[model samples]
Target: MKISTFISTLALTLLMLIPFNSNAQEFPDLDKSPMDAAAFPSKYDEPKKLIKIIYSRPQLKGRSIWDLAPVGKVWRTGANEAAELTIYTPMLFGDTKIEPGTYTFFMIPGKQEWTAIISKDLNVWGSYFYNEENDVAKVAVPVKNDKNNSIEAFSIVFQETSKGTDMYLGWGHIRLAIPFHKL
Candidate 1:
């Protein structure tokens, strides 16, 4: 009886030594620049999607837009990763036609304008590996300053137009609209 009691006590002690929830994992904190997506339809349950963009939203955090994205330089167009633009249907950026596929999006911020670039490169981390030779389409989009409302974080939104859709990029006091006409 004593031997059985000792065995039971030892088993209980061993069980206590082992973690009760060994499967529990330690998750990291939220990212400073969170991933976001903007679709043309905007609706969650929309069946057909004309275009979608996956990007990381980076906040200004009291930083200047010129400092964050310097003029005459290629920016990732977001935070960590270069924005990914998925075109469901063929669209025209200027005279250049972009086919239905996923492409890396980049930008060259300027004082009065910004050049939007859609490259063939995939899985790119940032503009560090951006190659101009892989550019599928490039368009010069005029920048508009919003004096009244200054956006803190980088944001992208789509607005329907009679031609197609306007993809607006807003950050700080700068705003740009790249028109993608249906082709």
Candidate 2:
């Protein structure tokens, strides 16, 4: 009776260990999912210019406006919710002045010059049905490549400077820089 009880206990322990051991294995197929925009923390406060750009993934895959995007094409830029971009203070991009307000961000990716359009419309999806006539400001910015690329997800980073701020968009091997001065 003692030997039989010991065998039963050992069998129960092995049954429990099987599920735990299989859980340790990694599944690459499970890694595909839409990234949460809230994962990127916001740094907004008074006095300083606060620009918050919110993006989402409506589809299974992600959206891109590059070689994935075509030249002379209008991209929704982001998923649902119009890819909202809120500016706290007045800012100047080239000669164009962007007031402190929320606006929908759209992009026209090209081989030579990528056009960044700030539209009065703040709510939209993919730019499949974007109206260029509603653009508040359109600025042409050059795209450059970085040697040491590490950023995997699409991101926008702001670097404060003495004059103003430098907004950078990093994705894959491309890094585009845009300077803005306070108005």
Candidate 3:
């Protein structure tokens, strides 16, 4: 109501709108992995690249990862945040047809193999409320495990192929690969 009071309130509100200087004091986890995406050129002879996957990398830290991605379990794919697959064009992701958009990535880990999933749901966390019906595709990824060869962290990457790309997941001495073809 008063002029002085109104000016004081406006000044306070403006200060709050300014960016906080908290970045210096805030500490970050050294163990926290970074988010990365793997993109490849399209097979249609297009100049631009397509088929991108964004995911976080989680280290094993000598802990058993099988507990989270145990046999017959529906895996969230990685840690922290759910993995995301973004395509610039329509393509078959793990045998499931998907249009140009982003998708949630999940998995079903088995002793012999792993099934990668492209889900219609977005921003899912830790496989919570994972619906089989929401999946766009559940394609089997060939798996190979070596006791001597240990992978330190969970990773999602792709290898160039004539048709499209061969997506690979490597973690804890285990590696799985699946195909994604551009239509």
User: Which model scores highest in lDDT?
Assistant: 1
Q: Where does candidate 1 have its weakest 10-residue lDDT segment?
A: 40-49
Relative to the true structure, candidate 2 reaches a TM of 0.68
**Candidate 1 residues 1-183, lDDT tens each?**
699999999999999998898668989899999999999877473567889999999999999898889999999999999999999888898999899999999999999899999999999998999999999989998999989999988999999999899999999889999999997
Q: Would you list the C-alpha lDDT of every candidate in the order shown?
A: 0.93, 0.67, 0.80
**lDDT score, residue 118, model 2?**
84
Worst 10 residues of 3 by lDDT: 41-50
Number of backbone-clashing residue pairs for each candidate, in the order shown:
0, 2, 1
**Which candidate has the highest TM-score of all?**
1
Candidate 3 wrong stretches, greater than 4 Å: 1-27, 42-47, 146-148
In angstroms, how far off is 163's CA in candidate 2?
Answer: 2.6
Query: Would you give me the overall lDDT of model 3?
Result: 0.80
Give the poorly placed runs of model 2, Cα more than 4 Å off: 1-47, 57-67
How do the predictions measure up, each by TM-score?
0.93, 0.68, 0.77
Considering only N, C-alpha and C atoms within 3 Å, which residue pairs clash in candidate 2? 76-126, 76-127
Q: 126 in model 2: Cα distance from truth in Å?
A: 1.2
